[model samples]
Target: MSIAVITGASSGMGEEFARRLIAEKDGFPGAPFDEIWLIARSEEKLTSLSEELDPKRCRVVPLDLTSADGIARLSSLLSEKAPQVGLLINSAGMGKAGAFASQSLKDVESTVTLNCTALSEVTHVVLPYMTSYGDTLPKKNGPRIINIASSAGFLPQPDFALYAATKSFVITLSRALNQEVKPHNVTVTCVCPGPCDTNFIKVSKNDPNATFTGFKAKFVTTVDKLIPASLRAAKKGRSMLVFGFGQKMLHLASKILPTNLILFFERNMK
Candidate 1:
């Protein structure tokens, strides 16, 4: 079956994407990409989601995108299944909660592995099938790519420095790739969401001083709000979507103000 592959599918936006696609079978408005291949590192959870979502159209592939073997295994899976990967969502990433100087080398490495290495590796391996002329994929009506970036991408977070860097990497990479594929009718939209309930805060927060304000204004955002907005931007092929009024304002501010000033507040605000 034709498909849209999404990483980090165990929970949060990843899981929501699967459910939303299944719930709305017609695909996102102007951009329609049917089927979804869910990827995550948990077998039990993937299996459960697959069953619960009525896998009539969804396929759960428990994948750890951070390893070479994982990529090899997925490449093999794609070869056999050869589902037309119409959409690729690089939603899998991790963050560390410490100043750059305080975080352990291993913590830094792991964060980079998931947030940068794995996502890029998946895109690297999968792009051939999705963009290549191979029998390995079913015919793609139109292909689209969406990377789950963060409003953190717009500025550097000194406390969460590494994580902020990774998000910036995602935002830049998505824009660069979008330029390459526009000629072939493919769309790439980077979603810079402020915050919603997600395990990221739990895993990334280790200190009492760790603060999340501007981007993750706890008072306003909810996953219920983010998912729909992202889908709408993806449908219209928006190059970048800074969700939430706060994030939109931040994006606009970045244009008029020096980045250093914008970053000053991002790293120091309440």
Candidate 2:
């Protein structure tokens, strides 16, 4: 059976993707997935989400990718089922906003663990399943991997140091991995979206009211808009997707301008 595995499926962009994929299954390049595996730590939320969709088609595998035990459970399930993985979306990530020195070791470790290590581990496990089918399926419709990175990855932020650095790792990894898997007809699309109105901000800042500031706030995109655009870009085999005009510009500027110049402006803007 062919399946689409989505991490962080309980909320945010991940939840949006799950709903849309089921709602418009035929529209996606790789249509007719037999099952959609929803991976997250919240069993309650995952169960509720599954009930809302086609329960028969939606399999809720509540596993915290950040934990080794959780990842082991996923790996074992994959081995047991041996289903063909048509798509994989790594959307489980977190960030704490503060000075690097001031942040607790736990928060810093969790950010790096979820954003970088877990993502890489999940991808490594699912990649074999995807690559195995690449030769038979057309490149356009072959297995796809979407990594939900952030616009913050483009530059280093003073207050959000660890988060930005980890996202940068995602961007770099996804790009190179895309090239490595291209020969196998598997495409990896890294999505770098600006701040969105989601639980992510509340968690990041540890305050409900905290959110983007200045121009960053102006370009914030919704999950409703971001997910569809990202899926479309991935289907088209694009290596990177920046959702908003502001974010697209930031991505370009990061490439053209020197790092010190960008950092100078970033420091002054705050």
Candidate 3:
């Protein structure tokens, strides 16, 4: 059976991606997944989204990817079902907003565990199923992977240290894996979206001492724009997709500027 697995499917981009997949009449452009497994920590939210899906077709896997038990559950499902993975979206991510030293050790560790470790594990587990599609490419409808990174991955964020670094790891992993799987006709696309107006921003604001308020409120994008653009980019087999013209410019600048200078500019931007 052809299926799609999406993490963080309860909210934000993951939720939006679920909505898009459900609405697809002829499957995702290049990749067509008939069944979708929604993965998230919030069972209630995942259930709510499931209501919008065909009960027989969609299965909600409510498990925190950050935990070993949660990852084990997903692995078990993969082993038992052994479904052809048409699409895998690793959108599960978390971040703490403060100086590394000021944050609790647990908080710092959680960011890395969820953002980097869990994402990597899930990808490792799912790749075999996806690659089982045989040696021949299925035209544009081959296996695809979309990993949600962040614009912070492009440059070093001073206060958001752990989170940014984790995203950087995601970017690197996605790019390298894309190359490794290219011959198998499986494409991995990493989406690096700038500050999007999602639950994430509200959560970040709740961090009292956090200095994340650089962009104007109006500039913040909705998930509507980011999700589709990312899917389209992935269908085209692009290695990386960064939304927003300003963000594109910033990503370009990060490549040319000195590390110290970029950090200095980011520190004073707000």
By lDDT, the best candidate is: 2
lDDT of 3 by residue, 123-211 (tens): 99888988876244466567889999998898888778888899999999999998898878788999999888667755554653443
Residue-wise lDDT of candidate 1 within 174-234, one digit each (tens)? 9998888776567789999876676666667854444455545553576677887777777
Candidate achieving higher TM-score, 2 or 3: 2
Candidate 2 residue-wise lDDT, 1-270, digit = tens:
888999999999899999988865654434678899999999999999999998999999988777779889999999999988888999999999778999999898899999999999999989898999776786567788999999999998888889999999999999999999988889999999998878898888789888777757887778989998998998888999988988888999999999999999988887
Tell me the lDDT of model 3 at 17.
92
Deviating ranges (above 4 Å) for candidate 2 = 27-30
Listed in order, each prediction's TM-score against the native is 0.87, 0.96, 0.93
Q: State residue 55's C-alpha deviation in candidate 2, in Å.
A: 1.3
RMSD of 2: 1.3
Q: Indicate the residue-level lDDT of 53 in model 3.
A: 71
Question: Order of candidates by TM-score, top first?
Answer: 2, 3, 1
Q: 43, model 3: CA deviation in Å?
A: 0.8
Which one is best on TM-score?
2
TM-score of candidate 1 on Cα atoms, chains taken together: 0.87
Per model, how many backbone clashes are there? Answer: 0, 0, 0
What does the lDDT read for residue 1 in candidate 1?
A: 53
lDDT of 1 at 189: 90
